[model samples]
Target: MLDTVGLTVAEGEVYRLLLVTESASAEEISGSCELDTAAARRLLLALEAKGLAYPVEDSPGWFAAIPPEVALVPRLQRQSEALEQTRAAVLEMVQTYQRGARARVGGEAIEIISGAAALRQRLRQLQDGSRREMLWFCKAGYVAMPPESNQEQFAAHDRGVLYRVLYEQAYFDDPGSVDNVVEGVRAGEAARAVPRLPLRMAVSDRSVAVLPLASPGAPGSPRELKAALVRESSLLEGLIDLFERYWEVGAPLRVTEEGRIGGAGPEDAASLVPEDRHLLSLMVAGLTDEAIAGQLRVSKRTVQRRVQGLMSLAGVATRMQLGWHAARRNWL
Candidate 1:
């Protein structure tokens, strides 16, 4: 372990041997470390040069270790500082390379990444390198990796990277997708839902984004999926603006005490039960009656009856009027 602080392995062994005794000669070090006398002497000299060992004047050819607290701690601290500086320099170099690559590629800031494997790798890279925030638009069908496979998301959360995710309402049609979203929310991800999304996207730190370039309905296998990694450019800025606008209109979701996903109801709807609030939220988010019934795990008739009751309570005669009243009264 001392090798991490600039000591060679053999030198570290010699230093350890010196620490246990008042002083040690090259011959003693060689015997204890299984090294020849010449090799032991060279290691001792190297340790001395590193300030980890010093020669004793009273006894020529003998050396003593400097206490680890005095000798090793400063070296470890300096290594830590140097590592931080290296990290900063690496980030700067990455930015510079991005600019140069774009210029060399005829000023195109978007680089095509083909195949699902490449897309997944790019997503992982973005998540790992993110420092501040990540914005996502999750559509119904996954093009690269599924929600559960994106372990980088949880890792990024632990690193204090804020995640703002917008899921298309139809995304919940998938089995276990709701549970996955709830799990993410429990792990500090902020999630919302909208009736539809224009495309799938993930933007990291407002500087880079990865988005599918193929048409959503185009026939293609997972392995054939193509995406574009966009660096700092006008296109990236537009994508960020698109995310912000969708976020503004999205319906927020929350995890209930029962571990179920519920809509985040307004304060004015305090009397509304959790189920009713969730149903209304889905309705306002443009889910069909069948879809809502599927999500709530009830029959179509049951959903219709509940809607009628809510309409009656809101004093409305039509579903449209009920929605207007709910919005006016902050029911969701």
Candidate 2:
């Protein structure tokens, strides 16, 4: 099939199974082809639509396969026509956009782009063109701040782009933070950490904001950090509002006592004179004993002892119960 009609391996397997099985239902084909039933059904429908498979009208959910030689010609012809139609539609869209862009950019303009290299080039242009600051809130472990050395970040920083980044607390513990710090120091970028962030984001000078799309490989792949950028100031303002809210609650990124990035807050340290209220606050914030120790530069045993003392003070058997009691009393 690959040599004759360029069918993919999975497609060929499904086609062969249908051909050999006479008249099989989607479930049967799925079982024979080692695919999910729904997925098999979709493929079978596609094959039928392309004339490679014909539905058996008398049989409730059965399909008959057409021989490859008989099926390939019509299928390929249909595909070719579909591709030509798509190409024309795309070309018309490009022309329409170009005209709109030209009219809008009479002096300065915004451009929409697709494809990897084009997107990268646009990002580089934006970063290079930025005069003031670049602000970002990123997922804990995913985005390697400053990306690679030779990437757009370093180049933008070289051109004097001040960067302020907020990261999730977990990211500090990730191996990627080392690269983050190395590139950050080299680029003179400032960064902070928060325990958790709502979503991934990047904004530049209130002129452009990038937000992640939820779909897989949406704007692009997660590793690619694909995002949609809006140049509209009103929309950018809304994004900035959200960014500031998360920034206010986020922690500063610091090397922990354990020599890792990020830890609990200062109020969580057992070495500090324990204020029952402060300890309760830390607990409510979800800091573990180890995190508390790292934050306070105390032994984890000390944190455990303090927690136990606090638990006994509250007359609670479990932390959740203790937290509930505290919350009920408005302690946190």
Among these predicted structures, which one has the highest lDDT? Answer: 1
Q: Write candidate 2's Cα lDDT for 301-328 as tens digits.
A: 9877877886787789987666555544
- lDDT by residue (tens digit), candidate 1, 1-332: 76688877777778888889867999998888689999989988998898988999989999989999999998889999999999999999989877764333326677878788888899999999999999999998787778988899999999999999998867877777877888899999998777789999999999989998775467988678888888889888999999999887676767676666666554757767877887886675456789779879999999999999999899899865675566567777
TM-score of each predicted structure versus truth: 0.70, 0.44
Evaluate residue 167 in candidate 1 and report its C-alpha lDDT on the 0 to 100 scale.
86
- Candidate 2 residue 138 Cα shift, in angstroms, is 1.0
Question: What shift in Å separates residue 261 of candidate 2 from its native position after superposition?
Answer: 4.0
What value of lDDT does candidate 1 attain over all alpha carbons?
A: 0.83
Q: In candidate 2, which residue pairs get closer than 3 Å at backbone N, Cα or C atoms, i.e. clash? A: none
Error of 2 at 215 (Å): 6.6
Q: What TM-score should be assigned to candidate 1?
A: 0.70
Q: What range of 10 consecutive residues in model 1 has the weakest lDDT sum? A: 99-108
